[model samples]
Target: MSIDFGLIFARMPEILAAFWVTVWIWIVSNVLAVFLGFGVATLRRYGPLWLDLLLRLLVEIIRGTPFLVQLFLLYFGGPFIGLSLDPIPAGLLGMTVYSTAYYSEIFRAGYNAIPVGHIEAAECVGLTRGQIIRRILVPEMTMLVLPQCVNMAILMMKETAILSIITVPELTLVVGAIGSQQYAFVEAMLLLALFYWFLVELSGFLGRIAEARLSKFRFAHS
Candidate 1:
């Protein structure tokens, strides 16, 4: 049977709307996860031993499990524990928590990449710890960590498709609905792939811009 690409393009408005839903979820979830991961790593790196152990255990547990299971537990299992959430919020919460574990490791690696001599030099220059972190460490750590963080962000964007399983009204779910309704599974699926590809390309473009801007700081300093 010949395919009618025209029918799929007819639904472009709905598809684009669904795409925005996916984008918003990804943006909010990644923002929260990245910052929270940094906070977790910083606390674990500098906090008391007991706190470090506790945070380490939490990260380990999250990293050890599949995100699908966590999403199910958070959305389907929450009602049993007297916590209820709508599908979108539950999905966002699950994604943020799960991604935070991996983001924390990326951040930890960035921190470790810093040279001891740099910190010592800042100390020798009479910079306070806060000033050293604000003026010295954060800038360098961002440069070191950005590529890995971008990779994770792209991964998270793809993973947002899974939120469709919980009926989050994201791009995949909308596409699935249209496919079933129109009996055009092949066309719908192709559109789905194309949509995701666009998102991935956009992410790569933005990441390149960020990396380029970060590079300028180094040249300016030099």
Candidate 2:
């Protein structure tokens, strides 16, 4: 069959709007994940044993489930549970919940990866626990965690597709609607694929710059 570049290009405006929504959802989710993950990691690393256990359980539950199911609960079941969130907000909330679980795991792993001697050195130098983690662990772990966190952020951006099931009108939703209307399934899908590829590659590019800047700590891993 012949290609229809015009058809695909014409539909891009709708897709562009969807792209913004997708970006916003992922950005807001990652912003929340940063704070939530730091707190979760700190609690798991140095807080009471009970709080650590609770965060571990919570993280596992969030990660073990599908994003679609989580979106449904927030978007559809929210009002039933006394949370009548706007559709966009509900989708954003779901993205935060889903991303936070993985972010927590990334940070927890980074925290654990710190060498025992590193902490001991800090302590020997008279640093408090908080000071040690802040001054030593965080500086080292940033090199370790940034790459994993960037990968997770890319995944979260792609997961915006699930928001469509909840009527959030992200990239996938717009593509689907156009594909149905134009009967240009292949073209529409190709555009969607291109968009996702761009998003992933963009994230990787940014991550590489961060990795290079943080590569000083690769010595730690070595």
Q: What do the candidate models score in CA lDDT, each in turn?
A: 0.89, 0.83
- Candidate 1 on 52-110: residue-level lDDT in tens? 89999999999998888888888889999988999989988988998999999998898
The candidate maximizing lDDT is: 1
Candidate 2 yields a Cα-based lDDT of 0.83
Candidate 2 residue lDDT tens string, 1-222: 766757767877787888888888879889998779887888887889999899899899998888888887787888998999987988888888778788888998998888888788788889998788778988888877888888888887778888888888898888888887887778888878887898789889988898888787674442
TM per prediction: 0.93, 0.92
C-alpha lDDT (0 to 100) for residue 102 of candidate 2: 87
